[model samples]
Target chain A: MKTIKGIKISSGVVSGPIFNFERGKLTVPKHFIREADFDSELERFNTAIRKSKDELTQVRDLVHNHLDEDHAKIIEAQLLAVQDEEMITAVRELMVREKKNVTWAYFEVMDDYEKLLLKTFSQFFKERTADLKDIKKRVIYHLSHEKDIIQPEIIKPSIIVAEKMSPSDLMHIDHKLTLGIITRYGGVDSHAGILARAFRVPYISNINRIQEIVSYSEIILDADNETILLDITDDIKASYESRIQDFRRHRDNIISDKVANSTKDGVPYHIYLNAGFVDEVKAMDPALIQGIGLFRTEFLCIERNSIPDENVQFQAYKAVLEKMNDLPVVFRVYDFGRDKLLAMLDLEILQEDHVFDEWGGIGFLLDNPEILKAQLRAILRASAYGNTRIMLPLVMFVEEVVRTKEILETIKSELKREGLAFAENIELGAMIETSSVLEELDELAKYVDFFSIGTNDLALYLLGSGRMTDLTKNYYHPKMFRAIDKIIKAGNKAGIPVDVCGEMASDPYALIGLTAIGIRFISVSSSALAAISDEVSKIDVQQCGKLVNSILNADSAFTIYSHLKKFYHEQLE
Target chain B: MVRKEIKILNKYGLHTRPATALVTLVSKFKSDVFLEYNGVKVNAKSILGLLVLAVEPGANLIVEANGVDEQEAVDNLDRLAQQKFNLE
Candidate 1:
């Protein structure tokens, strides 16, 4: 069997038929229309237009009912294109004058319009070409009496093989039959990728020409290893199938125990799960962990055409809180900016000197106070149902914390005046991500109830490396560890609890270091919770503390990493 | 015919959604509407037509409408542009 490597977004193993689901380019077959069939041909074109409009209306209504108004607007936009008198008249003239088939005429009109739009609009507006193309394909499919190939009905469980899947396409995919998804182009942060993770579907992207390579083959997708094995032998397939079964069995056992949160040396610490979508929260068993540490609220805004109202926000937060059964849930305010632009909000992004620089966390929130206030009001309203806390991301200054508190006070008073029932003392915290925040940790900690150190950004910011782009493994240097140590120490001095809610906290090696540094609470992805808990139960906290202290003294990142590796195998492992 | 010149003011300029809003508004009136930018004119009631104008923030466009509801259409579109297409 040949193996293809791809960038894995979600982890799982499965074997299924490769459903070659490509959006095949529409080809317009030319035919000379006879004089007698002219009137009938024109009538046929009108019928096709009517059918196309009906299909779009149904799709729009379905999207509106199933998803949200914003998603429905995508189809609505296409409907408007269908109703464009200019486009209709152009197609009608082309068909009647050139004696061309309806499909050919429609395609020619759309092609000419696309060229004109390309010439008229700037490069920034060039992306709209895809939307225009989508409209063309939909109408042409109706004219040709062909089914829309994008939304195929899968009769059995199968792996979806495609060039790319849009967010709208991902929303419409039948989860039962879609065993896994492999695409030729996409990033882990793409909407389809995010949706795949949220749905717990095995997905990988950026495999070059995956659609052409494997044609109707029974493929084994080992997403955990980022490999897709084509045409496996029966013996190999049996082994792989058993391996998947073993993994599920192991996972079930780990999740079933409901183990207490304490190290072997009896050092009790809190393990919290990071969740974004409500579906991910529902998939999780609350009995397994303390509570949700980082509830990424941005997912609620991602697919919508308008800002989610306070009541909608309230329902989402309330559902999570009620599901947790009073477990303290920390709702992070919408951390917009960078690649996470809310097209609906149209909030002005603060210009950075470099295009790559991000405008995330509290900075984006503070710039749009109306959004911030709405989210605060929603979180506060939800807090009435269960235990909840508010956390601000990317806080680098003391003034940010002070200003946020001032706004929180204003919201609280407004709620009180309205006679709304909300938790009066919803604990507010700041995320210590930037080096600037680390430097002023003590001063900043005094204004907040707790500190959650987002080590992903902290490490990247400390080393001046892009978190995703920098291929060098040395980004997580001993210098970064020193920063973490200083922040934890400062939190202690200020008498505020410090927890880590980043990728570093999830790593077994980093968890040892964090525990040694006296970090009592750690948050990790929900999928990593059980595995990390197992590691935590094996460690002797006192010994880890000593080992970390020595590792921190190392001259370089390589030296520190090596020491930790040796320590893990010899003592912890 | 009623005509008015207005400047786009939203941060994102007259992008797809804002253009859709403008077209949807103009389509409600019986007046035939047209928008002119950089000496290129397009039917204002067509979303694709408006999108081709590629109006950036601070760009000026002359909107003209003719028919029974010409005045209403021009006044409404002018107000919408002033409000930044209600994008905020």
Candidate 2:
């Protein structure tokens, strides 16, 4: 019996069998040249290539129906791999000239093509087989048993430890019969990690060589602390009993409480959630949030090759609003720059393409003015049911706002002519993110109903920060506070309802200071709202106001942050 | 050659799904049907050509056909758009 230690991403425990699956890897083995079987070897190599292509098709068929668009791309990529010219050429050369066996030729070509994609690892299934017949038998078994066997009725569930799990693997695995996942291969931010988060399942990635540790039995997992308490001895069982009690206590507290955040002094404030995809929208329990803060309408408009029609948009918006019931839900109009938008629009490559242009662009919208109006018209039509506000992204000048408003008016009049009953006095807002918008805030806010300060864009734009890498570091930096101060002061003077929609709203300390800075409505992820609101209820906002006032007087952001941190520790108690 | 006019009726105008329906409809005809918007004529089968025209709702689009069954081609396309097929 052995125990393994790894990072715990999800919280749960179960004990089951060591069903050792073949891990994909790459290794070059020295084989003696046999002149007698040379003709047969070449034939075998050609047959293996044919077999590999067929297997790819089978896997694609199995997953195509069950997987989402993103997962389907992974299968498409694998199919592309099967037909790759370089791989095909290499296999042909080895078989026709080098006289290698079918399996050898396939492995050799995969090794050569390994470096092209980072995630597609090339690994030979090395087993201690005495003859070629044995290796072929194992290969057949692997292919035949690819259909995952799941028995949910089995009382004892097994923990699945793999190098990485594909989307199909996740779909097939019986969640009721499976305890958890421990991967030695994937990053915390990879697709698998995101899946685990979405499923609300406990998983840990980046655990090194987990297979060598536990013999698949007699090992216990503690997902809550990401620890594996091993050696199922008599004393360990006693300890497990005690830990179970503590686990139940923790679970009870989280499941029972559902509070939409209020100020420390019992003052009410709106805490809303931002949803991009339907899965995320469906996952949100509205009893936990005030309303949908910002439904990123761009996903529906920007994901596919062409924009979705008003009815498609209507179904998505109506479903979300219906789920929320009477709650006020806001939708941000499709924000597309030159790069993110599809130039050669097709259904397949639409989601695969990135928003990268020579002008440091992040979207595809410059040439597509009609697409923008199509989206705006859709949003206006959907606003007829429940309270819906239309917000624009990357509005830098007053002219853009005026033109957008004119477009809205045209759509509204068209709707009226059709005798469509729509939301009267629908509020229009702009995301204050661009430097140009900041400079023209006073004038721009006058035309819109409110302002949602997109600090993620604001910080990146001000510091000339990279959107992907510099987000976390720059967001927490003191310079970000100074920018917040400017935006808050502008919003306060303008009398427009302003809310922070960036990741910083999730921060416990930032939430406190934001309320202290005189900004009330804060939008964050639904998961963090209850926790942050609980923290807010414990702080003295008046004292935090004094601390903010002192911090604002400081010369630099560094001094201001340090002063606030120290004040939070000393005075909050 | 034959010409037929149809008003854009689907809430989604000549996009991918509707583009697909229109292509399938035109492919059945012996005559080649051409879609025209703002005086620019394009092959009804060309997805890229149709998208460039950017015909919204309530706009008048002209369909011209030239082939063995030109009249039949024009009649079929006109019926599809006017009836708002594949939309409901």
Candidate 3:
């Protein structure tokens, strides 16, 4: 029994077979099973193949209906591969002869054929390779999950051990069956780590030899102690079992028990969640949040190769709003440009050189008015169900909002003409992220319903252009706080509420600073709620106001940092 | 028994569409059909087997069949080849 210690990301104790998920790649687990398990393993392999066939047929039919017959033929070929008897026999023989698990045997067989088809993984064979690889991953996905896509539970759940899990990989995994996650080289601050933490998965990182540790049959993870126990004895398992119960009970209390959305003195505030994907939207407890402050719409389209049509986008928006009920849900229009580009959209890379050349978020969307129309149409249609607001991303000009309002007016008129019910007075808001927008905050706020400060981008634009700076390290600068302070005052003057819906909203010291500046609505990932609420409960609004008043006007970062440290130690600690 | 030599004339040769077409056509006839090229022979009824051969355009394959309707299968396949495996 070897025990390895690593940094604990989320606290829990879980015991399960470890699945080695390489970053952005699906790797097949090559593990042996008992000979007595051969029949069941083969059964599992057959079931996976059946599921793959069913999935392919549905997709093929969908293509045939919506697209041309040529696209359907590609899926038909995959269906042929699934039904091929020789591949099935080879898989069964390999599993029965070597007593291997179903996924192991199946992956080996398909991989051998894929290698045969394309000797080198090159551009010329990309389509064929992609087709074959799609079939492979589909079967494996079916084997891992007990039911269809987006369902919570999985059959043979495994703890994911990765070198580094990316955000896309985080989306691929179903949280309910993922017992825990341990990466060889990820910090708790990494994007994937934060996501996993938000999803309430037990996670740890910075362990050596991901390859070495993943070879074990099963693992007992004691994240509370940052210890992984392999080859556990009966006595150790017994002790850990009780420990697991205690840990889950403690954790459940933290999740289910609501914290007051106020300061220590009962000053009222609202806590909202920022959700990107369907699972997060579906899993939200409306009682715990005021609404989803920033429904990242681009996140929905980024994962797919094709642009989602009005119906797809409408369904997604409808799910979120229905879940939120009457709470105001802000669905940000597709924030695509610069780093985020759609594959199917006829768009060139929006380079930094084009920062001011009609390539801003609202500019790009206005240029591609079709994408904007589809999103607006969807959000407006969904508005009939619940309280919905449309927020534009990276707005630098009031004219952009004015033009969007014009487009919305046309869409609303069209929807009304078509007999589609929608909220006629749906509010429109703009994200105050761009530096240019900060200067025109009062004017921009006038054209919009409200403002949600995207501090991540605001800081990047504010501190990014300054001397001797890495955009990553320069966050929540005093200059940024001053900028946010300005945005809040302008928003207050304009009689529109301002929101902080960025990483700064969740960070302890930054949250205190934002609260001090009299920002009331804070939106963060659900994982940050407990900690933020705990900090909120520690001090009154008066203390936060004092803390900010003392140093927010200071010229030096050092002075602000020292003051914040002193304030935290004096009050929070 | 019926045997004939045919050349792959489709744009992608014996790739997915042509391969699937070949398998579907051969599987329908009551015959044991086989395609031999470069000393490698595979069951004509299996798409994977036909694709593994990777018979390129203008490549010749000796198609052999032996069953009650062997002649009909070979005749229909020859007609398909003449039309470039119904490339569309």
lDDT tens digits, residue span A1-573, model 1: 788898877677888887777552455667878677778777777887786676566556644643456556656777788878887888778877988877788888888777767885477567667667767755665566542332456668889888877554564457768888998866654556656755667887778968555674688888889998886899889889887786556434435656458888898888888887786787667776688899988777643323467888999999999999988899999876554543222112111213445567898778768778999999998999999999999897899889988998998899899999899888999998887777787778779999998876776677765533322344347876788788888888888888998767766666777777688899877556777888888888778778765767878877766767777798866
Off by over 4 Å in 2: A1-261, A277-288, A299-307, A335-367, A464-473, A553-573, B1-88
Worst 10 residues of 1 chain A by lDDT: A344-353
Q: For candidate 3, write residues B1-88 as lDDT tens digits.
A: 9999988887666777888777778889989999998899888887767766777778899999999999999999988888877785
Which candidate leads in DockQ? Answer: 1
TM-score of 1: 0.71
Please list all clashing residue pairs in model 1, or write none if there are none.
none
Instruction: Note the Cα lDDT for every prediction shown.
Output: 0.75, 0.58, 0.74
lDDT of 2 by residue, A107-141 (tens): 56554333322222211111111111212222322
lDDT (Cα, tens digit) per residue for candidate 3, span A1-573: 789899877667888897766432455556788988887777777887886786567557644653457657867887887878778888888888887788878878888877777763333333366666667666776676543342222357788887666554676667667888888765544445556666767887778867777888788888868888888887888878887777556545434646457778889887777777776777767776667888888766544323567898999889888888799888888775433441111111111112322244777788778778988999999999999988898898889999999999999999989999999888888899888877788778779889998876687678665211223234446887788888889988999989988767776766777788788888887767777767877867887788766656777666666666677678888
Evaluate model 1 with DockQ and give the value.
0.38
TM-score of each: 0.71, 0.55, 0.65
Instruction: Point out where model 3 deviates above 4 Å.
Output: A1-17, A22-113, A118-131, A134-157, A166-168, A184-194, A205-208, A216-247, A250-259, A302-306, A337-364, A463-476, A553-562, B1-88
Preferred candidate (lDDT higher): 1 or 2:
1
Evaluate chain B of model 3: give its TM-score: 0.95
